[model samples]
Target: MCGILLHHAGDDDLYHLKEQFLEFPEGSLSSKRCSDGSPIFNSIIPYISARGPNYSSLRVSKKYKTAWYSSVLSLRQPFTCQSIEIEERYVLQFNGELYNHEIVHNDTQYIVGLLKESAPSIPAIIKKLNGEFAYSIYDIQNGTFYFGRDTVGKRSLSYFLDENTGEFYLASVTGSQPNFIDCTAGIIYQYSTRSKKLNSDLSISSPYEIATTMDQQLTKLPNCIDGLFEHLNKAVHRRIVSIHPAHIENSPISILFSGGLDCSVIAALICKQLSNIKKEKKPILELLNVGFENPRTGMLPKDVPDRKLALSSSEILKNLYPDVTIKLVNIDVSYEEYLEYRPKVIDLMFPKQTEMDLSIAISFFFAAKGSGYTISKDGIKEKYQRKGIVLFSGLGADELYGGYHKFANKSPDDLAIELTRQINNIYDRNLNRDDKVIANNGVEVRYPFLDEEVIKFSTMEIPINYKVNKMILRKIASEKLNLATISDEPKRAIQFGAKSAKMTKDGNKHGTDILTS
Candidate 1:
């Protein structure tokens, strides 16, 4: 939910270092002094805050020109505990919600308390923690830094390290950097289970070839459903806990609610938790739903009918939570407009794949970004300052819950197999779209359906009948939150909802082009 920038001089090259720091705007700077009387310079606050209401905190070291910027976004309010500290020469930044924080805290205190007994290494401390997290710890103590994006890669952390300067910049989104070093194209490495070690990285000519090999190996694993669910749930819970209350109370968390089970579930869970906390005042939970205008003549596919799921979803949500503010945007862009924006959308979403279906999906993302949900006060003048708003989406629900027509013939055993396959496919297909659309605006995204706990419980314990076409989720919604009324209704993809006119070209039909065709 924030951006961090650091500049270091290998020798007495202070002039260039200062110039680099000045390139980002003056108001963006914030300074704090360390225990050793060194000043830490930071400028990410103004850049992030102008995007929306958020709690911004910064730490900078004057001697090192090393800065750490952290912001708790209102979109991720009601977080557990969030803090960044500089201990000696090391800077630690963590976005996480530890299930066993109290226990770990006490253990750390006890260990640190018994200085005469022994001390734990940094790696040992990391091993004692359990949860979903993406953290970067810069050890100025050793002039070396370490960063990891959790074991499951649920939380995102991307960085570009300067080989010439040994300077590293890290952010939650990949495209945040305007300029980056051109690292050679392909790299591959494998982790050894027996040795519990990672192999040295290797470069390859074709990344897809390695990916295919890995996919085949992953498909061979037993209990794929259990493993997939476990990882997914862990991802969701990690993000939920990462929300800081100060940030939530300041700006309010925004949810892209489609009234579908995935987004609806996330909205419900966040609302349920926020209602319990007694903050400065109850933060607003904003729900954004986008609709499209009528299609042109002959645009409708013979098989697909118009369905306003966005409007219906808003109504259902209003019935459930009368307090939330729902913003529905009916996009009226013409086919010509779509063509104009198609390339940018394609570049953002399908940077790797140029398939037509992905392009269609990217069009929906383009419309959503333009819907004003991610717009900041500064406007869209610059991409980085557009907004730091974190968008919560439900991208993997259909794939994991058998909500697609492809799962119609799946038996109980076959259902598990298919679900696992779909879950794996999410990273390349759905995650690609989600990340591209939101990150293009400098906004972060969270997928609650991909939560590890929810995935594990739903897949391992819940009966197959419950998940077959979201049957179990519907029942749970009725019993736990009364969500079943709309569960039986058919699911609609965003592309079909927003661009129905484009669906019938060349005798092709909507939905069929994707699932059955």
Candidate 2:
């Protein structure tokens, strides 16, 4: 929903704290006022305004001299303001969608209400947490703060501490800061205003538990297509239904499509749901496909691997769902444009600076930018700047369903261990970087395959036979959904498919190379 920040002022002078980890992106101070009617920030950094382009604010507790900052994207109703405060005793700053449908109108309010009513323990709040989030709740009465991200770490949260004065810091993003750390998901830390040091972390279930739950659910039903289909269907439906009507006005539901198994599967479900669930009239759904113009390989932007795949898949979708208007928005980024955005992409992926990160970020940055074109049925092209606030990403399918082919050769035991590792590493390897890059474009990114239920059913539940090459998901696509070659296409990493890799004469640069520029 927004970008968030919290800082505990060690000294009365807030000016010195501003120049530390916060002095990177740009130096325009945010002008949004807090609920208490005070300026949100005296200074700011990053492309901070972009994350919460709809609303921005800073809430301060004069007694503690601590400040909480939240910038909202406002994709739902109730236009809930943040930092959300309740009973004048508790305050919250959250950045994520509560797709749980717990608070259909305003997720911010739902969470702030929980933080207000729940006990001091972290479990009290986590037991009900649903969907992706990075959150901080302050107990004004007790001088305590609780902060954590969802177990899958689907959102970004970074932290820093100044030991000399026992001051604490947190932010949605802190780019390449000397001491700031991207907080690990599934761990909650409590900070006391009196001690200023952090308390022992309240641990939650490990990501491995998700694997365990999937196994348990799958044991009873050998053929789990019906169950798997049910969960998958619900996952896509909740993501759409949760957005308020007013917020989704005229904004097409956009997909970060790759024309591969993952995105095509999601695209099918979304098309089905808009007709069955939303029932919105002749809704236009955009398939945002990104392709890069790499000169080294003689690859034209229009002919990039993913673009061809998208054109093929677009035809499949059009043939399948004639009721909905399916627009394939080809987001072609030129070499010049890539160079122009490289620096900003690097900054957005703060603390994660690698050629691989840059490539992936650039791919998503342009895709989400949606500044491309949509072709008419008559083959005429029309310029389209996607106002797609809700961007569906097919991110977690590979991690959850064994989409990587290498795991196919591993033994049963090794495969289980590998799957567990993939689940745990998603936070570091994908979610953080992807979330920052996608959100930087002023859009919210959602993972349908990562829905807690979807994870529970896919992990260990579907037969190991189907998991190889993600045959299980492929089966769902082919047998149940009746999709075409999309159901059988081999997996392709987005960077390679989009031609975002090996950008220059450093064409031989490995994907893992630490970015120097």
Candidate 3:
């Protein structure tokens, strides 16, 4: 994940606001360092360097001052590829990834290339591509700028226009907290860039409104289970293989595991995909199980549901998959640690959705910090690859499938409606909050369940009953993958599994209040 900043000062002097743009929130500017270990503030363009520590590039015209910054974790290196100059008339600044990187390195390159060749409409060009991206293309010749994000809203992009100064500013994060972030001026405005015209409201759907698409033909299709499995497997494969240093045979892929059905199924699929890719060079899997210290007991394993469940599943996978090595990363956070990280988590989440802050923050904080170590041949040292830690999260299963307990007793019609609503509203539910929290450590979170194809099939093509309680998913795991032990495990919410929900009981309970103001 990289940071892209654009400041178009219509009348305000750009130099006067240098300190605000050049510094990161929470006084982290001092910690921002380049590849050479020098402070980012020392760079020629400090604001660009501050946002993107690994690499920074800038383009300035009389009307606009743009900065494209990329950290070491940049998926396709937008700093180099997308920052191309064409006749010194057009420039691109991009942040995020394109799944079709083999053909086009970044969104800007693809969009600009299309413009150069045929100059098609922006929406038409976006429809032809698949990936999560936020990019800005400047036409110096026209003195106009075009900036947008992916259709699915997988990446965070926000813009604030100071009507007083006639300056329009766009950033990965618009504000850190209430009454903070002078750029946003209190009102939160996010980029709702989409391919298909979908409503972009950040509202949670009611339980009855969330349901799978009521399609009768799904059950009639031959090899239905295999088809669904293939789609999910492909989703996992895409994310796993996309990691930089592409072929790090020994690198471990991390999974936020609760030993429940959803995560366990993902674990099995990853192992299967890795085995198919290379029988000899099997990838190590890290199951990160976070268990918080109980306030009542002040103990480590204080009856945390995830602890026992994760332990059992880890053992089962270790015994079942010979080629795959399973590493259980146990993250036990003390109450003090939780308290210290809570405010930071809230601030890091742009707009600071306070209602679900504790639960989401707690889960992601531990998940982001969890790491797997590779021991040296002599067994004297361990190594941590900060960039290569790819996180696999079972996020969309609850929305796509009827994994939520609330949906258990819903009628078929209600379930169908509920699934459709949840699927449509999934991006805003917790995706942005989850992304910001996880990306804090530069580790990218990939959700195979949220794959565009998988989502379409699960929500539109598949029947609603198949998703209720994830019955069909369990069947595939037990029958095809031989994971009956985990397939039978009940669904447990991440907050409950990690003891976060219980701890934050008295804290803000109204999520709507956070977004409204």
Candidate 4:
């Protein structure tokens, strides 16, 4: 949820650093000191101070002859000097939530305890975690730093490592630099179920479209439902742990609730957690439901009424948690408005532009960020610093649990394999958009359904019938959370229900877009 900048010896001088810092004043840098222990000089670019927000920090180390700078708007936890470790050969700063911290911490302690040893590879240690993240660890020992995005690339981590000068630069967004390479517009291929093959028609710059193919090998039969539920529960619990109670209590945390099964499940889980904690005053939980001002004629299906889905969702949420506040934002703007913002959204979501077709999915996140809610803890304000804010999203529910109608006709084994393909597609399509848009807004987003624990459980041997039309998920929700019967309700895409302003060739459609300059 914050910004970190690192620079090694390159073409830039002290003045260049000052100018760069001035551009992002909300950023800070490492510094150098004299032998007398007095503050010697600033290491961050000066442009950061003049134009960016007034929140920046600096640290200097004579031992390593290195400095670090940060312009942090903390969402997860407050930034403390003690949390940052500056050694003789390393400078490390991270902006992410370590979901398996408890396990990792325990394992680290156990290993260190047994061998009586200390390890300098924090990144290597961090790779053991099971959640979304992007971070860089500077190793002065090797004169090289290591930066990586999560396995799914949920949290964006982009770097500019100049092979010519051996200098490294990292940022959450591409526009952070004037000379950033235009890596967009590349041919991005994806495994298409509809075509039953890998296709290279998609682009990193385009919107994400949902496409599927029928698998004839799987049978349509009832399967084990309890196992899937067990996995989902574990996933929810892990995501909840990522939400530092201290952070939520200090600042507002917003949830994007479409009233769909995925979001609804998350909402119920959060409410349950809050009640279990027994905190007299709960953190401000803002339920955001975006709807179209006029969906009857302009965009929606002829049979569907305006705001029908949102209304149903809102009603259920109100009945479930009357104490929680719900806020609705109507994006009544025309398609023109959507088109106007398309470019900026595309750039933010697909900085590398390996494909142009992914822009559609990216636009949705831009619209959400424009509403001023950070989807993750890192997206929160500095004054409200804590571990991190956890934004719950229902990302992989539809694909894994067979929420889509496409699964109705397929056999159990075929459905499972099909679902696996869809889940894998997440990385190339929605996952990147979701992670980048939130990270660009300096927020973190957590997907309980996409949790590793849930994935492992759902993929195990089970009856395929239980997954048909999200049968397993609905049963769990109804029994465990006392949620309304979801089996009877039809599955609806959020973009369609929200009456998104984008237009397609088919009609005023949810995922339609016209190529533009």
Give candidates' CA RMSD values in order.
Answer: 10.4, 4.4, 6.9, 10.3
Sort by lDDT, top down from the best: 2, 3, 4, 1
Residues 62-108, candidate 4: write the lDDT tens digits: 33333455544443333332114444444555544556645433221
The TM-score of candidate 4 is 0.68
Which candidate would rank higher by lDDT, 1 or 4?
4
Q: State the lDDT of candidate 1 residue by residue for 395-514, as single tens digits.
A: 667865678877888666677777766665555445544544554444556666655455545555554555557755555455555666665566666655444334324445443243
Could you estimate the TM-score for every candidate? 0.61, 0.91, 0.78, 0.68
Best by TM-score: 2
| 29 Cα displacement, candidate 4 (Å) | 14
Clashes of each: 19, 0, 7, 66
Q: What lDDT score belongs to each candidate, Candidate 1 first?
A: 0.46, 0.78, 0.60, 0.49
Q: lDDT per residue, candidate 2, 133-248, as tens digits?
A: 88888777778888888878999988777766766778887655657778788788778777776774576665564233334345544368778888999999889888776545
Backbone clash total for model 4 is 66
Task: Indicate the TM-score of model 1.
Answer: 0.61
Q: Residue 98 error for model 3, in Å?
A: 2.3
